[model samples]
Target: DSFNAFMSLNERAARSALLDIQKALGPFRNERVLAATAVTDMAISSLQRRSVTIYLAPNITDMTVLRPLLTLFVQQVMDLLTREHNPDALPVYFLLDEFRQLKKMDEILNKLPYVAGYNIKMAFVVQDLKCIDEIYGETARHSLLGNCGLQLILGANDQVTAEYASRALGKRTIRYQSETRTLELFGRARRTRVEQIRERDLMMPQEVRQMREDKAILLVEGQRPILASKLRYHAIEPFKTAALASRQNTVPVPDVEMARALPVPATLPDYAVDGPDPRPGRIELDRHEVIDDAAFEASSAENVDAAVSSKERLVVTARKLKSVIAACLSAADMPMNQRISIQDVLAKTIPDPEEVGLD
Candidate 1:
C-alpha cells in the first residue's frame, strides 16, 4: 500500500520513488523517513494506502492555480488519514518546506487538529513569518503557528517578524538608573547623609552583542534558543553545495510551437449594424431648428402648465394605486412569474428611460 499519492504527470516519477520508500520501510517501524519531496503532479489517490505523504509543490506566483490544488491535496490527505486506523502504525511526520509558496496554507494548517488524532505531525518550513502573514494574513499566522508544537526560525531581516519571534521566545527586562548622592547640613553643626534612589540589573555586554549577531534561532515548545547555532559555522554544508550544483548547467530551453494547424469554418455570416453608431460624423444644427428667445419662452410656458397638470394627476393616481403597490409587495401567495412582472412594471416606471442597448 502506498502512503503518499501525487497527482501530476510531471511528478509521476517522484511519486513512484515515494512508493518505493514506503515499500522498503515494510510496515512502518521507527525509521528515519527521508524521501525526496513529492511534487503537485502526483495525485492524492496514488498515496491513499500509504501511512504518510509529503507534498513539495513548487512556489506558484499565481494564487488561482496554487490555492485550489493545495486545498484539494490537504483535504484529501486529511480525509485519507481520518478514514483509516492502525493503532500499531508508526507516526507519520509530514514535512512541507517553502510552505508559503502555496496559497491559503494557513487554512489547511488550521484544520490540522483533525489529523492530530491519527498521530500525524506537520512541520512547515518558511523563509519568515512575513511570508506567512503575506499569504495567510496576521490572524491566520497566529492561529497556525500557535497550533504547531515547535517553531524553528532561521535568519529573519524584517523587524516586525523579528519582534514576533522575540515575543514568542519570551523576554527578560533589566532596569538601571543613575542618581546623585549628597550630604545635607540641617543644623549648624549636624550633617546627615542624603541618598537618591537607583535601580540596576546584571546584563553582560558580550551577551547582548552575540544576540545581535546571531542569525539562526530555534524556538521549541515556546522555549528560548537554549541550543542555537550560527548557520555559517554549525549548519550542514551539503544543502549549500546542492543548491549551487543545481544552479549549474541549467540552460534555458527555447519554446517550440507544434506544427499542427486548427480547422476553420468554410462560410462566415454578416449582420446589419444597429443602435448608436460607434463613430458618428459631427453635424451642425440648422438655423430654423435652433430655438430663439420667443420660441423658448412659448415652449417653457407650455411645458410648465402641462407638467403641473400632469403632476397633479400623477399624485392622485399614486394615492389611488398605493394600496395596489403595497398589496403586490406583500403578496406572499404571488407566484414567481407574477412577482417578476410586478418588478418589471415598477422598474419601467423610472423617469427618462434609456434604450436597452446591446453590445
Candidate 2:
C-alpha cells in the first residue's frame, strides 16, 4: 500500500511539473511538436554553448507529471547527443539531485550508454542506498548502479548499506595488543603483552554514518568510484546560481490570470435548448400480472435445469446492471451506500425492460 501510494504521488508530481513547464512556455506553434521537441531543442542549444538548469523543491510531491517530463527531456538530450552534427567541444550535463523523486531512473540509466557519444553527462545524487531500492526496485537498482562508470559513496547509516559499501571499498588488516599470563615454575607467574595482527572486512559503522551525513557519492561516467568531498555542499549551489543568472536574461511570459479574466459566452450554442421539453408526461401500457405456473412445475422437476438457468441469467444480468450503475454513481460522486441502492434498483428494474417502459 505504501508502494502504491508512492507511485500515485509520483505520477501526480510528474503531471504538475509538466503543467508548470507548459504554462511557462506559453503559446507555442504546433503544441504537440513543442511538447515533444522542446527538450531536444533546448539540449542542442545548451550543447552549442547555452546552459540549462531546471530546479524544483525537494518536497514537491507531484511526480505523475514530473516523470514523463524528465523522460522527454532526457530523450531529447540523448537525441541531440547521438546526432551526427553534435559538436565535440561542447559538453552537456544533466544533473539531478535527490533523483529518487523521479520514476524513470532505470530507463534513463539504460539509455546513458547511448548518450555518452553525444558528450552528455548525467549526475544523480540521493541520500541513501535504500532510496534507490525504494524508487527503482532491487533488480533495476542493481543494474542501474552497476552501469555507472563512477560510484562515489558518501556516509551511510544503515548496516546493510554500509556493509555493501565496505565490501566495495576493499578491506585491510590491523594489529591489536592483548595482555597474556604465563606460568613458568609452579610458584612463578608472569604477565606479558602479546601483539597480534587480524584481518577483517572494512565495515566501519562510524565512517558509513559520516559518509551518509557529510559526504556525497559521485559516480562519474558510471564507473570510477570516489567520495566527492565538495559535492555535499556545492551540488545544489551551481544549479541555483545558474538559474538565478538566467532570470536576468529571460523575458517574462504573460500571466495566465489575465487570460482567465476574459469574458466567456454564457452558454454553448450546440447545447442550447430550442423547444419545449420532450419528457413524456403520461404512458398507456398493459400491465401483465403474470403468475408463474411453470415455476412450480420446474421446481418439482428432478433435474431443476430450467430453474438453475433462470437464476444464472438473473445473476449475470444483475452483475452487468450493477457495474453500469456503479460507474454512473461514481461519476456523480454518490456515496457508496447510495450507489449500492441504485445498483439494487437497476438490477431489479432492468431484468424485464417492459417494467421500465423500454419494451
Candidate 3:
C-alpha cells in the first residue's frame, strides 16, 4: 500500500513528488526496491537507553547520504534523552568523531549549550576549526567554541588552528634576567644583573603546532591553560589488550559481496539511459545476447573515445545534480529528517553512466 502510494502516482504527482517535502525522511527505506516507509519519533528511543553505541561510516561509500542519516539518529536520541531523563539520570556522552562530515545539525548544535542541564554531554572530534567553518559556517563555529567550557588543543598540523589555540590560551607574565660580568682590573670581577617582567602567550603558535602527540594544552574557564600529556587508551585496563585483539580479529569481505550488500539504488538515473535499446548500436537488445570476438574487435577507436567521453560527461552531470539537490534541500524550509527519504530515492533513481552495451 505504501509502495503503491509512492510509485503509482500520476505524471504531475510524480513531478511534484520529485521535490516533495515528505521525501526528506531520515531512516528506514527500501533502497534496493521502489518503496517507501514511515519513520516515527520513537524509532531511536531504544538508543537513548543503550549504554554504549558507536556509529561508523559505511566504508568506501560516498558520505553524502550517510550524513543526514547519522544526524537524524543523533538528534532523535538527544530529544528522547532530554524529554525522558531527569537531572539525576545517568549522564549521556555523545562522542562524535569527524563531526563536520554531517550536515543540517546546526540547529541541534545550537541547542547543545542547554543539553548539559539534562545530563547529556557531547565531545566533538574534528580535524580543525576550518572543517566546521567550511561546512557549518563561521556562526556555528563560534557558537560551538563559545559554549565549550573546556577546550583541549592537541598537537596540530595546521597553522590557523595552532594560532587559534595559542590565542584562546591567552598570555602569561614571564620574568627575564640577564647577567653580565667584566674582569678588567684582573683582581676583581663585577657582575650586573637586569630583570624584566614581560607578558607573552603561554604557548606560542609555533609551539602549539610542534607540540608532541602525547601532549595537549587544556583551557578551562576562569583558569590558566595547562599543558597535559595524554594517556594511551591501550595503557588502560581491559581496553588495551582487548581493543588491540578486537581490531586484529576483523576479517575482510570480498568486493562482489560487499557491493551487493551495500544499500544502493536498484534502478539507473533517467539521464544515464541510452535511448530505448539501453545499449550501444552494435549489440542486440536481449539479455543473453553476445557479440562475436571479431565483431567486438571491429569497434573503431573513435567509438570507444566517444563512449568514454559520454560517460565522463554523465558523471559530471550527476555530481552537479547532487550539488543542486543539496543546495535545494538546505534552502527549503522542510525538516532535515523528512528530506532524507527523498534524497535516498533520488540517489537510487540515478542511472549508472558506465552501464553500456552488453556486459
Candidate 4:
C-alpha cells in the first residue's frame, strides 16, 4: 500500500508516504540494520584498563555502525569520568587510526586539549594536512594539532603537508663563509673571505617530501625535532609470534604474568534479520583479571626536574602560538568572520596554568 501510494494519490501522497510506519520500517528489516540495532554486552567501564585495547575499523558494508559506536564510546567515557568514580578508572588512551574516516571526528578532537585532566588521551593518524583542513576546517586543524604534546610525521608526499611541516619545524641559524677572488693580469690572484649568519628551514619542503619510508620526524613539545628510524614491530619477537601464530600458540610471548597483559574485545555474533531481537547486555562484559599491580608499578615520574621544564614547555608553546596568531592576522585566507573570533577561541582554550598547577 505504501509503495503504490504515489500512483494512488499522485502529488498528494508523495509528500507523506515515507512518513508512514510501513515505509519507515522497511529500512530496518535489513540484516545489517538488525545487527546494529540488536542488543550487545558493551560496558564502558570494562574498556577502561591500563593496557592496550585496539578497535579495528569496520568493514565498508558496516560503515554506518561506526558513528554510533564512536559517539557512544565518547559519551560513556565522559559519564564514567564525571558521574561515577570507579576505583579502577585508570587512564584511557584512544588510538584513532584512519582518524578522518570516522564520523563526527571533530567532536572527539575538539575535546582533546582539555581532557588530559580526566586521564583521557588520544592519538589521531592523518595522511594529508590539506585533507584534514578541508574535512574539519582550518581552525579546527590548527586547534587539534597545536595542543598535541607530540606531532609525529611518518610520511608526507603532498606539498601542503610538506610546507606545513617545514613551517611547524621552525628555523635554524646557519653560518657560512664566502670567498671572492680576482685575477691580476701582471701577477697573482687576490682573494677575500667573509663570514655571515642567516636563518633557514631546518627541513625544507622538498626534503620533507623526499624523506625515506623507514624514517620518521618527531616534533616534541618544547624540544628540538628528531628524525629517527620507525619501529619495526614485525621484526620484534612477540609481535612476529602474535602475527604469524594461531590464537592457541603462545610461543615467544613475553614472560609477564598473563593477568597483566592487555584485554581484548570478544567478537560479537552476527544476528539474522529473521531472528527475534534480543536485548543488549545479554552477554557478559569483558573485564580485567586480578593481577599484582605493585610488581610492575613504576615510581611517580613527576618530579622537580619535570616541574621546572613545565614552564619552559609553556614558553615555547606560547611563542609558537604567537607566530600562529600573527600568521592568521596577516593571511587573507585565515577565515575570520563576524560570528567566529579567534581571540575568543584562544582566550577560552588557553586555560589558566595556575588552575592546572603547571605554573
| Tens-digit lDDT string for candidate 2 (1-359) | 85465456677786876687677455344344355445533334555465556554423553543455555556665665565655554676777786876655445766766766667678778777788888678787777666667777666668767776766765679999999788898769899998999987554655666654555655455354566555433257877677777876898888654222323342334322563322332212235644365754553563355445555776777787788766775667766565556556656547675433345
Clashing pairs in 4: 39-280, 40-280
Structural similarity to truth (TM-score) of each candidate: 0.42, 0.48, 0.54, 0.56
Models, CA RMSD each: 22.0, 21.9, 19.8, 34.9
lDDT of residue 7 for candidate 2: 55
Cα lDDT computed for each candidate against the true fold: 0.57, 0.61, 0.71, 0.68
The prediction achieving the highest lDDT against the true structure is: 3
Let me know the TM-score candidate 3 reaches against the reference structure: 0.54
Lowest-scoring 10 consecutive residues by lDDT in candidate 2? 277-286
Please write out the lDDT profile of model 3 over residues 177-216, one tens digit for every residue: 9999988676798899999999998789998888888898
316 in model 1: Cα distance from truth in Å? 74
Q: TM-score of the candidate numbered 2?
A: 0.48
What tens-digit string does per-residue lDDT give for candidate 4 at 176-295? 999999888987899999999999999999999999999999999889899999878677878777767765675675665422333333433343234554332232223664434442
Sorting all predicted structures by lDDT, with the top scorer first, yields: 3, 4, 2, 1
What does candidate 1's lDDT look like per residue over 274-346, in tens digits?
Answer: 3332222222234468766777667667666655666676676566567666766698588866565755556
Error of 3 at 4 (Å): 24
